[model samples]
Target chain A: MQGDFYQLLKEQGYVLGMSGQAGVGQALTTATTILAFKYRDGVLVAGDRRATAGNMVMYDRTDKVLEIDRHSVMAIAGVPATAYEMVRILEHSFKYYRRTQLQELSFEGKLRALSKLLKENVPAALAGTGAVVPIFAGYDAEQESAKIYFYDILGAEFEGVEYAVSGSGSPTIRGILHYVNTWGEQPLSAMSEEQAAVQALRLLTSAAEFDSATGGVNREAGLYPVVKLITPNGVTAMADPHLRSLFESNVSKGS
Target chain B: MYEEPYRWVEAVGNRRQYLDAQFAQGSPVVGVSCDQGILLMTMSKGTPKLYEIYDRLALGGMGHPADLEKLRFTLLEMAHVEGFNRSASDVTGSRLIKYGIAPVVKQAFEEVFKAPFIAKLLLGELGQKAGKDGFLTINYDGVFEEKNRYAVLAASSSVEQRMVEYLRPQSCVSLKDAVDLAIHAWAIGDRAQRHTDDTGGDPKDGKGSSDQPVADSQTLMTHIRQCMQGKSIECVLLDRHVAGTSKYRTLGSGELETLLPKDLSSALT
Candidate 1:
């Protein structure tokens, strides 16, 4: 039925995944995100709690994104339109081809879909940067395993080195991810949240330290970092309150 | 792929024969051999029950086989005498057919049982527990867990990795649950022995059997009972630990037939 609704939208020429599910957290769900590493057993996906309107932080409490389906999520940023449209397309695709399709999409499929959409939106994406980038993660039933995906402005998808990073601050986020992946290892499940938080904080703080666009949650204490985790169970939004102590540790260490 | 080269089919056929023999001898020890894996039809397609299980597995199968939920649901359907998995046969074909039980009789067996049920047994829970690392020690009634879809065993070794198998119930009377499970254990055990001989796991000193049940059911004890369900054997020498543990529990000298009818007991005894 919703497929029928989405099909109608597609024929009308509006992108399918851009319709945001507004709720307590994300307004349009045009978001920024990261996921935990793929451990020997599984993988985790994470996101920062920030939505931006170009330079302005449109919503801080926003979840950046949420799980459209349980095991995986479509976390996006850039134009909220791109974010919501991608989610709708994927969500509907899963519903329609569910029985026949395996659990997770191939890393290539993940990127190709984004690329096709991004390439389709050549007008806006090239103009003022309404380009969308998203990260997809889940267990692939056929592969009988887990994987993560990251996309760029032109719809270029990358199976990130370890962690997947997308959004305005991704270059900076990518730095945080690199440091975490190096220390925490690609599959983050083996480590505790504290280790992960520390990795994330250090990265966010490091990103915020240099990249003005990226800040940990404690923007004043000097690092404002908010992070989320996507594990086998599903998405977990790490609050700023919890982030404070970890952020404080790094601050004190520097002091 | 359609014809499934004779070697592969025979490998599976051997496993079915082993279970059939186990039943014929009234012996509980059975060995299952498979190339890829077997699909046990648990229930008919499109039922709300199967749908719920499939949905659950979709969300939960991260680290393990998510198919088991559907297996359980299929079993539930079979127990209730429901038709099952038309999609499976129409598509999967002979690959789906290798599993011990047949689809046509699944509902009949399930109807006899009446609680319609299905199960997917992972290979890990099939073998012995605790060795050098002390990490495998466990205590539970059933030697294995009827895990959700997230926990299917995929290892292809009898040395360390056990086998994961599925079951289809012919009726809801709970009639074939034990038999089907026993046949599955038989397949795994035999596969482990042949696997060890093939891989050199030195099963006697290693985990006792290369092809242990993925469920790790203390095969020596529980699965021995499982392996020799309707027969006249003592304890299945399936695992030394199970044999020794039974002695500790002061259970009889493993005179299995004493637990059942003499006439039927002689079949395997």
Candidate 2:
């Protein structure tokens, strides 16, 4: 039989939803402000480090952009507890399929797998307790190019042709991306790796400026947003030192 | 119907003999730990005998491909699920063999009404540091043993013992040396199997003559040349130095050429 880790877990009575019925007054920990866009070499994915429960900041160093495999990543932007569980399942499912089937899961198959998980989580999502809106980015080896996909809490998947954004600060970042990609000097897809990273830092800074849930770069704590690049080579996370230097010289100076 | 207990035991013994005969001509797989990581190598006509089981684990087997594939999937599902529910470090080779695979295999073997799995598996786990690597070998009867540093899976216990003896004292520090030693170990097991076939006798009987003589380098080279005529070498490495969660990598032919000695690399063509 084809190895399905998620199914195995389900058979073992492990549920991915909240333990008890979610009450309306319950404040769930949520994370946000994740974005992915096409760049010169491939796709650039970025997520801020802020996780908040209601109006209070729960954590500031959460890694929102998680690498699922060598070529793929899932940038989560909703309930942290639920999104993390989904990411773990995705990571294991991809690997399980590859090992058992002796081939990598097709890009379409991967997209469906995520959609299936979201569909299964419908009960929890509808209760307003555990919703996960995520942006999936990866280099499609078969297509010889990078691709970006975004999903709603109900599992409706859409291809982000140029860019995609999600979370509480999504409206602000989306508007800026559309404006820059349309009338800016160059399109987002034409930007170099360094340029793409700088743009991501500036965008997250702008989101934090306007959104309370969005935590921007904490210069005092030396914590920067998680930035990753998906190229034909593989997914590579931009280090904090590099992000710090880029924010100081390019993004901060320009603003 | 084997209504009597003695009859059931006789039938089980017959099954063992049948399973042994089935694996007589199967290729041997050699696994050794080196500074680079754990290396698994085998010679096959077409179907792959080596596979990546998890991030830090690999499997090499000698048996019917269908049976091996079934066992491989079983291990894969268990490992992935355990890793997801628990953590990566919790998914160890010993746990998979002891808890997951051994029970299923034992039940299948003892059922008497069902056919037993005609496969011998060698599992290698790359540890977090040097000298911590582990290798486990499982038999068709569900018997398994865990060893440190090296292990081998062959057609019969005698051949496996001979290969293990040859590798017991050897230590390799480089990938090239590990590959060379693994090929030699594979040659030893393959030669013993061929010897048993030539005599038209049981492998257990053929072990008597092979026990005293460890083949020299020249003999191993000749045997490797003779047996590798219509086969290709399949090698996989669980490299510790690789920068990723998954360390398993299949060495391609282009890379294998550099690792093999000049004479052996030229002979394959």
Candidate 3:
């Protein structure tokens, strides 16, 4: 209606007759398990590498973690197509704001924008065609620390106190993270960056054990979980070699 | 020269003259990209006109204020559409110039119904890769050129010549050095401007600055302070090797004061 890209696409006669309600009639390959929390220095954000369509494992090396901007990341846990679209829109809007305004969006500003986007997709989400929930993690410049936010299907934003998890496998993953972060002598709030990363990998591994939709590291195919560290220094993904070594060590340690 | 139809040639000629007159009045804007990052400086005529086009891109121009505003809105909208159509992270300085900006300026010139933009645009982009920062200057008739080390926009022939001499061998200058160089070049231009009768013709005003005498460094410093006073003189930076969250930022007036040499800075009101 308004001369946006979508409108341009329609005017150019690339018409998909389905209503423009977002993610209608698209094959839904759902990704699972994203957990984020504050660590000693910054935030540790991790996602398991699996996507499924009902009983079929559609993808084994899918990337559920996405970089939203310089200081933030979004981990998706619903229809992969819908989530990807949401991520692209958010990225464009954020970059547009920065370019025109000459400043990064405040942490609260980002939350509001994402919430609005999810709210707009409520139609498709309710119709069971485009349900997308994402966990947001970022280094809050004003607060001077890492913070995480969770969202429901209706886009109600909730701040995570110690840690947060989402996806079909989230219930299992959340339980494991809560236990590891709260029940130990050195819980998540007290863990170093290295320890937090290790715990994230362990949580994903534990989630895959019970949740059929979730997948742990695939050693034969050299596929590993995506783990990112968001700090004042910037975002850095854990290398495959390091992930492999960490997985081996964690598995070798008998429970 | 390409032959033009007789009917519109007079109109085109008149437009050229009008634009040339406009350029004569605008203050010189200068920028440099070095190892430290990129520095863009422009003389403030009152309101701030510089815009950050993206995380690593910023733009400033001197021309008709209305035309500048129109260009800003159009360019920003086009870039937003481009970002939406593709991945945002992939949108870089080169991509924006090659795909979005150049074409739009070209359109303005080629279309008869559209008046040629009477502005000089200076664009600075932080290097996406190591040692790849870029600076670009675009003229009114849609002529665009990329500069490696330094670039100047909206300067007179006399001032441009002086700038060419000052900014030679523009390699690996520190951020503070780059800012200093920009200021010095602008001062030379401003000093030369005082000798000319019509140097201060405000493109915005039908008339424009008084014919002042030549300035020494102290007088030049004073003049710079006076012009920049009470204005939000903005500076855009693209830092390399900095672990900070944002390599791009707009430095405030206080932060800018810290970057100036101690002697010139001490006299700031």
Candidate 4:
């Protein structure tokens, strides 16, 4: 069963029309904007809930943030189907390593594993039908600290010193994060998990304001960006009500 | 280059019997349900037999090392696959054992693969509802029985006898009592005398250790220290009360020391 399932999935394929050699003519309508940062308690991972198909919003409650394991999470920013299959494959691979080895993989090991997965999908990525860019964040038990890793389509792993953001709206979010870090009295790492989560939501809201692909917190439908806190305690998604209040509070403050 | 013909041929032997014989030499695993949650204790001679199947689910195996590894691997893959296929709230220890491992082991027994895994399993998981934690004892041959209080695997007859004798008919037990009873069961192999040293409670009384349990956590910790002299014991607790992320964790020596009756810092010395 090792890599057998992945091989089977490879045979099935993600893009309905594309084959091994053909490239997707147009970009896939996809979710955008995933931001992660290390704070005092742990790493905060966030993503907007909107999935856009071209100019039209395909889904408003799409979840781009996925829990990879108990301690780690990944945010997908391309080809929803490919992203899901990749997550499943990675999740199975991580658990397989833990089972056979009887120990969890190191943070570096996890990054390498993700890299391998992305590298294997290089052909599909080149075909443009199966591209997935992800931001990974987790609490490293051995190092006793929160860590964040970003990956390109080619699966090049890059460790972010303070924060990492991905997808089309990343530029906007990154700009805001830079502004916050430079203007704030303390480094981003000094902020609490709650503060970091709030900052992430605010940044995503701003991204949604400027970028059509990103979705803002919708008070009417009660949908909010998915926010997860990966603390020493464990990885948990912030409750909708909490995110709602944060949105309301932030909105109450004038621009 | 010459390739060995029939390389996949399994050596002719009683594989099931051989697997069981290996378990005879494997470590003892004891699981007990207490007020705090479920406590799973096992001796580690280097290689670990305990595994976290999920955030709340865990499995402890005692059998052929290869078979144990296979079982652990298959079980975890099934769990994660099942979890990914359904909602997270749908996955549970009992469900994994009942619907997941049970089928795999059943197939293994049917010789779906090379040979059946010779691994007895003790599974513990935090309950979906608060205070509903579960513990299950599974035979290597796919037979399983749900134990409310406690269960033991690959142990001396006396240890099994003591567990059945001490925990039967009890509705609930405290974490301290569970730890003491599990260790006491494991320690029974060394202590040949049948006398109840802690509080003189009759060994056969079937009163359930929690009925008039003599040892407090501290006293039991000391007793455990005395029993485990010159030995390192691996302990895990699936605490239901643990809020946030994961409810299962291995107890560190430092934390275990804090639970001891006295500073047994030099007890082994």
Candidate 5:
């Protein structure tokens, strides 16, 4: 009868799924890694391209650094499906808010939205389900400096003082970040492409060296890219050639 | 042997000075009605080719600066022959301008020779043509449509067109090429935004700004084609029409395209 006037499918009793739980047709949770550090120019986020389901690798080459606003970039890790969907939802929300509210939303406001999305997906995340943990950063127009924020599955948000790391490679990425040599917003108007290229390589290589879950630099494929966000300007991905050149420079310098 | 059949003749006077004929009191300003729906009339045409885009301006009201805010929203959608016509009960009812109907001539000298803006005028005509640009009555008009065509510029509309920013996605094999393409796209986008509707959103808005839900990559390419012409073309007048009746053929639907930032860059080369 609901079908008679567009009723709920719930009464139809259509149940479906496999996996280890009531998976229905829903996607499985595959964890990924996202890491970020603030530079004098702007905030920089780096993410590895691998998403793992349990101990088994599910996908390689997934993007983690995402443009959140005109002046922000979010580095995320955790369930790829949930994180991907969450980012889309946040983008739409940002646009709606930006238009309705003449004032741009705050960085904390962005974190709050992420928290809600993650909270909504918590039930699945707890039951062999997957969750998304993200480390976000953006240039705060009010403060005139880059700010960092973090969020958990239950909508808990925290602002880390120095830097933040989340996802599969968090432990390893965080460990190396201790020796990153730098963190903090600056007076510069922007981060040159070269500087961004260098920073992204540093974060990705740190994970590649210690964490098996994170993929090494992808110099060619356009898909599953990494990006950097500086001040005033939005997030930007160094092109393949530039990334390759940076990697080569790193190798030569290391030797 | 000396005379060529398919030769060009110099157009009489200056086509750029189409609006120079003494605008005394409330006379019509010479300008092209662009699809972007902005006022792009030439203020001066000399060394740099100056054009003023009227973002908002009107002829009525007690003349107060505070009204600018309200007019900003109205100009966002209004244009000539296509300007908004709301009844007295409409949102900004009192701000409506009343005027007479006249055939703003397309310059007699434009014919008998070649116009510097033949291509551009024809391109605009490819989009929309023929509508009221005068005044309307005060009433609680229902859903506005072709049914409500008689309307003039509200006092809130500033004459200067706002500039829009744009981005171009360059499909490049090398990074250098990509950067170059991106920059080229910027130049084109900047030119269009500055020369036309300065108020249009940035090029990044892309399909979002178009009335038609421009989904595929092709429609953007068409938009790019029209943008580069620089002049607001009205009709593609053929030789017979131009010489005899000052007539032109209406461009059918799907006749023109919108170019993306990247598409414009490709054409630049």
Candidate 6:
């Protein structure tokens, strides 16, 4: 029993290694197309709801953007099994630290904790079975502002000052975000919440056009990407109805 | 030597006596379920006596701060680990007391050579609906009881019983009513405790005497007024109406003022 839930799990012999488990990674269910960027109020995080196993669409209603706490969210882009596990550990670790220490974990400490988990999963990641590249967007209460961070499979972390993108469809959306942020009418930070959401939908739609793994939108089934906003208040998920209206008026109408 | 089984039992008995004396001046904690959710209130000289244990759970205790903190951390570790390993819904008050805290506190009490945790803890869990709320109280010796609607923790068993009896029939429909009821119930327990202290009564013997006239409302008001001179009130709620998964929240003084009565609210400032 320790403040670090991950350490406690490890001590209980629940290892995260995937090497000995043969044939498990052959068609691993991998989630794709997660993006985060700064807007007027705070950071906007969006992820397409698609899980792919090789060339097969395994699930369409997967929630890639997970709220870790009141002020933080994690958007995963790789293997769902390992990514979900990491999310569970990170959620408990943050809450456990707060309860035991009588204070919130420092933003730096939180980043380091996630990095440690990824580092510990280095074996699985290196074996090509459990690679999770994730974007973490959170409101730093101490700093009184929102921030974005991206992590690699090897545990390296980098601050995404303007935006960060991940998964198989990232290249397509990444180019569009760069072009828009640099030469469009306004940079990403100046956009409002609605504009930022619209841009995210547009980016995912373009990625879906180019990448086979990103499920941009399913109008008949009313399935849209998960979009959440991290502001000074807290993280709030955009409801499907709101997303539907935004997509219809802004993205689907080709305006 | 404690090597002998009888000596070990004697030592454990002595530890219980020591603990009872230590809690002589400790304040009482009152918790009641209302339409809003579960409300926990306590009067403290300085240190906070209420805490948010988990997403749907809150805690109140009467004991040494250090011991309470030790147990709080233990419970927190267990809860988060269980919640992470299993799910949040699986981490209930009874499970936490039965499987997590009770064993640790019991071991410490029985060890004889080891210092026991001198804390009496009350945990409240907000259920999915109004009628399903649960409360559990754990004594220093790790004996616990699962209760419904309301629970109270006092320095002695007699005082706890009196407080429970006073609050047994009261049903609160709003946060204000719940706060009001809890305060009065707390005053009952505190008044009895002070009576015992004044007379040097042995708490273990349940000598706080039932015939001792229950303080009238005016007398209770005066007692609470005098006690509030140097103490602060700690109030927490597990709001079922909250938007997120975590329902635990601390009521700030500003909100407490609204919920508390005119004179009591003014006395706090």
- Identify the leading candidate in terms of TM-score: 2
Model 2 Cα shift for residue B2 (angstroms): 4.0
Best by lDDT: 2
lDDT of 6: 0.89
TM-score of each: 0.41, 0.96, 0.77, 0.73, 0.46, 0.95
Candidate 6 fnat reads 0.75
Ranking by TM-score: 2, 6, 3, 4, 5, 1
Better by TM-score, candidate 5 or 2:
2
lDDT of 5 by residue, A6-41 (tens): 011113341111114645555454555576666656
**Which ten residues in a row are the worst by lDDT in model 6 chain A?**
A16-25
What's the lDDT for residue A19 in model 6?
Answer: 54
- Whole-model Cα lDDT of every candidate shown, in order: 0.40, 0.90, 0.72, 0.71, 0.41, 0.89
DockQ for the candidates, in order: 0.01, 0.84, 0.46, 0.31, 0.01, 0.66
Better by lDDT, candidate 3 or 2 = 2
Q: TM-score (0 to 1) of chain B, per candidate?
A: 0.22, 0.96, 0.79, 0.71, 0.18, 0.96
Clashing pairs in 3: none
Q: Could you tell which candidate, 2 or 6, scores higher by TM-score?
A: 2
- Model 2: CA > 4 A from native: A19-22, A253-255, B1-5, B208-212
Name the candidate, 1 or 3, with the larger lDDT value: 3
- Measured by DockQ, the strongest candidate is 2
For A189-218, candidate 4 gives per-residue lDDT tens digits of: 899766777788889888998899999888
lDDT at B148 for candidate 5? 20
- Model 3, A137-208: lDDT tens digits are 988898888899999978899999888999877898777777776677787877887778788888888888
Window of ten residues with lowest summed lDDT in model 1 chain B: B132-141
- Candidate 3, position B112, lDDT: 60
